[model samples]
Target: MNALMAPFGGWNMPIQYAGIIAEHNWCRTKAALFDICHMGEFIFQGDFESGGLEDVFTFSVKSIPLGRSRYGFLLNEQGGIIDDLIVFRIAGDKVMIVVNAATAPKDFAVIRGRLRGGLFTDITAATGKLDLQGPLSRDVMVKLFGEAVAAIPYFKFITMNILGVEAIISRTGYTGELGYEIFIPAEKVCELWDLLLSDERVKPAGLGARDVLRLEVGYSLYGSDIDEETTPLEAGLEGFVNFDKTFVGKEALLRVKEQGVTRQKVAFEVAGRRSPRHHYDICSAEEIVGNVTSGVFSPVLGRGIGIGFVRPELSAIGTPLTINHERVSMEAVVCDLPFFKDGSVRA
Candidate 1:
């Protein structure tokens, strides 16, 4: 396969297998397999509360039910996001923390520093992750792994034997589709990847398609949409933050809540086929209000869709705005999240 390659988070990754739009459409209608082995995974074992893991993130770690996962962020003292990640509660004394590849080293140091007592180790090198996503993903998993695979619900996972090795198959994904993320031993990833692709319904997808799939569903991409300088509140992700819990940035977040955020994240749709790009100035009238963080020409919606940060007052629905970059400009209007809504994510 003559795949386009690109550098991402210190790894040379496939940007597209066939083409971005073709793979994106395939995921919406059928099944798309993604090699997500470049992500970072860490293991922590010990007492969640006494080990200081409970207070490390914006959410309560010990409160997460076994076999389930929670999405939130690690923040600095200033309430800025360190990284948005997911915590999978594997057992009473252990949890798996999945983070972005680029921030793995920093995230490890920060998390280890906060822990007073625990057994923590990086498992990224030993683990290989693959995501099979689309409306028909459940059927494929069930057929390949037996009926047990179908029993898992969204946000939940099960430890199962795949290719004779224990693997974690979670009903979670970046794409807005019914999907499963399988974490297998590093040695077996290629075998399993090939096995899944052997099925007629499954085709290999790449980062390009994954980005479009996630954006279409309004999911933010770390380092692009949300970053170290952006707070959850400013990113319109306050629901993931547990204000009731004690966290590193709790005080700063409270102060922000009291003072109110000046700018807010907003989703908008372009008037035509013109796609907005990152760093494009978002203007209201003649003044610049914000900048585009992520954008794509959506095959699902047949228009350009984008996300950006704008003044609080301009974040309302139906507000007209212009996305400008050099001489390129496009008309857009603030709209509801999930430009494409009929996804099979929960189905």
Candidate 2:
């Protein structure tokens, strides 16, 4: 392979050009860059109802205001998530759906199969994504893309000219900070990367750093924290689901709600340096309860943090627990999510 490759989601991807921790620290103090070309972007060019796009997700696509985006999931008949996505309503008949990289092909096929009418196209290869994230993201974007970039509100986006080409800049990101996700032409992505790096405050970051950033803020990793076997209600993600709309998994979710969840997602923190990891057994005393879905060593909190599933009764603050691996065990407690409370996510 011509490009650097490392393991991710059973695929080899680039780890870094410089280093992971170097990139991580840069994002915290200054601007850290990211190349997200592996993400999937799809365009649906038809009215929400006519195209059957409105019912595709748990929320109404047509109700989303113009130039704004909403995050939610596509569910199967059993109420399990097909994928988590952000939908940007660019125009009346034009919507941009951003999907995760690992589920790109399956998401496209499933979404297309559900649509009754419309011009649907998977623009993954033709589109390129980059994230310039930090407290200084606005300033950097404003400096390059002009005032239009500076005016975008949180969760809102604008399609404008960048580098003389049409591009979309949204004030949305995985990190709990002021950031922008720029969608530009595939060919111009490298150019934008070079231009953004010209600023002293901007430095390139990799997916490794991105993962840490997102996790630090309690943001759920799609495949890890959720899957086809879990419902939004059980995941503590009911805020993203619309009860007013009829969508796939609504019935299943209602049923799950009535039945009460057997298990729910919970966030916990270690009292010391040892970190929890995926599949690490969670236990109250010696009996295994659940497994850690996602975990990381948090730089901001100076402790290890993670999210996992456990019995609802056991999910409580100050509950003492232990994370167990084969020959490793760590003392942990069930603390609140977002161990790092100070963030510019909504700023």
Candidate 3:
């Protein structure tokens, strides 16, 4: 069990088992197994309206059909997001909430404080998550679980028996690749892990490769690209925030909408291989505008790509810019997200 370590969201986690590039390529071409056991999960069984669960998240939970999940933020009273999470509508009144690893405790406290009744349990320890991702993910699931998994649409999940145990297979994944997040009892997780790895197509990948993959596809990392200080409007994620329904932060967001946002999240590409990193200043015609929040070397693009906060006017596509750090400077240009468009995420 040789594992290299790296820092992630205040936790020292495995970067890769074999190597980053090899694991990444394996996931792209064949199949890859990822140990996502660090993520947090909760079970909430109660009336959506009466338990105050409906008013908790930025999105409506009742609207999510059974076997489906919705992604959104949980905001504090100040319109600041406490954490971003996904709610799986497992049944009529039973929902499972998946949250970030680091923010699990905070999210639990916030939700519990808001709830009046029903059973809410933090099942993080009892839950172990493994992701199987690749162009051939569907083939693997279909062969292993049956056609039910194959027919499941994107963002939908199906609870079925795997290895003689109940498990949930969700079509949603963080990596911009065809993948499934398999949630099973913690005791049985290692069994599934070994089962998936027994196939010649699957390899083990860690958080490092997953980050680069997600960022390359222009997906926002929870704490990096967005936080309590930034609203969905400013973060370019208003699509997840339903304006037609009401939530805790609706008034603040609506007020901000009326006035317009000052700083907006923008994706950019460096002119060369020199990657712009976090806190690197972004300049336009030598005038400072914003700074990079997340940046990485895109293997597919063979160049540097990043996302940053900049003046709304300067956050347009093809805007010429320069990224400057302490002793490193690089030429960059604003570009649309999903720098790599040919992902096999859903193929």
Candidate 4:
């Protein structure tokens, strides 16, 4: 397990084991194990209504049923996305909020400031998260954990005994695969990792392969594709925002909805194998209209796939664009997302 380690979100993380492309391909065909213990986990226990938890996010937390999870955004007063996170309803009065590693501190502060009565506590130091993702992930998990793991539907979870401790196994993932995200005590994480890797069907994947896998499925990266300066409306993620709910950023989003966003997120494919890098200029008719946020050479499509923000008029499908950076240039065209669509996510 001699992995190339690098700094990510203030933690030393594995960037690759064998290679990025090799791990990416292994995940597409078999099972891939990801050590995601760096992510932040918060526990909130109290009344959903009076505790002020329901109005903190873009979606209604109280509406989430027991054993279910919801994905939404935490927004600032300006309608800008603070972070994209998932809320898991563990019980009637308890929920676990999972957030990106780098933004965890600020997110905790922001959420705490908004709450009036809920008992909120940061559990990241005591918790560990591992994602088992890929087409064969379900089979691998069921064999190791038991048949109960097979019954958990997408966005649902169950609390069970594992490694002599209570663990939560959620049927959720970032890779758009039929996978599971297991939350266990930090002390037992290493043992669980070793146990999972003992199976020949599972291979360790690093952040590099995770990045490529997420991009192929059109998932936005927190720091890159979406950030504090970019509102969910401009990022083409307004669907996650519930207008019916009274949230912190509702007014700003309403204003944006009325005035319309000048720039919008667009998915594009390069004409060849030349990958579009972040910060590359996105041009239309030789005019720089926007910039690339995230880009990668997609092995599935055998082309360059990118997510960028451009003038609304230039975001339509099939619209011609040119990505340029210094001396490098590549022809591209706006295309639908999920450049690779054969994922076994819902299977």
Write the number of the candidate with greater lDDT, choosing between 3 and 4.
4
Residue 337 in candidate 2, Cα distance off native in Å: 2.1
User: Could you give candidate 2's per-residue lDDT for residues 1-347 as a string of tens digits?
Assistant: 12345877544566675666677777877788888888899999987897788889998898899999999999998889989999999997899999998898999999999999999999998998999998888888888878988778999999898888999999899888889999999999989989999998998887888888888989989888998888888788999999898888789889988999999888999988787999999998799989899998988888889999999988888888899999989988888878777877677
Q: What's each prediction's TM-score?
A: 0.99, 0.96, 0.97, 0.99
**Once all C-alphas are superposed, what RMSD does model 4 give against the true structure?**
0.6
Residues 1-347 of candidate 3 have per-residue lDDT tens digits of: 58798776566778988888777777777888888888999999989988889988889999999999999999877677788899999999999999998889899999999898889999998998999988888888887778998887778999999988899999988778888999999999999989888777777898878888888899888788888888988889888888787688889988889999999999999888987888899988888899899999888788999999999999889888899988888988888878888887766
Off by over 4 Å in 4: none
- After superposing candidate 3, which stretches have Cα over 4 Å from the reference? 7-12
lDDT of 4 by residue, 231-339 (tens): 9999989889999989998999999999999899999999999999899999988899999999999988899999999999999999999999999999999999888
Q: Candidate 4: deviation at residue 20, Å? A: 0.3
Instruction: List clashing residue pairs in candidate 3.
Output: 177-345, 178-345
For candidate 1, what is the lDDT? Answer: 0.95
TM-score between candidate 1 and the true structure: 0.99
Q: Residue 183 in candidate 1 has what lDDT?
A: 97
lDDT, candidates in the order shown:
0.95, 0.88, 0.88, 0.95
Clashing pairs in 1: none
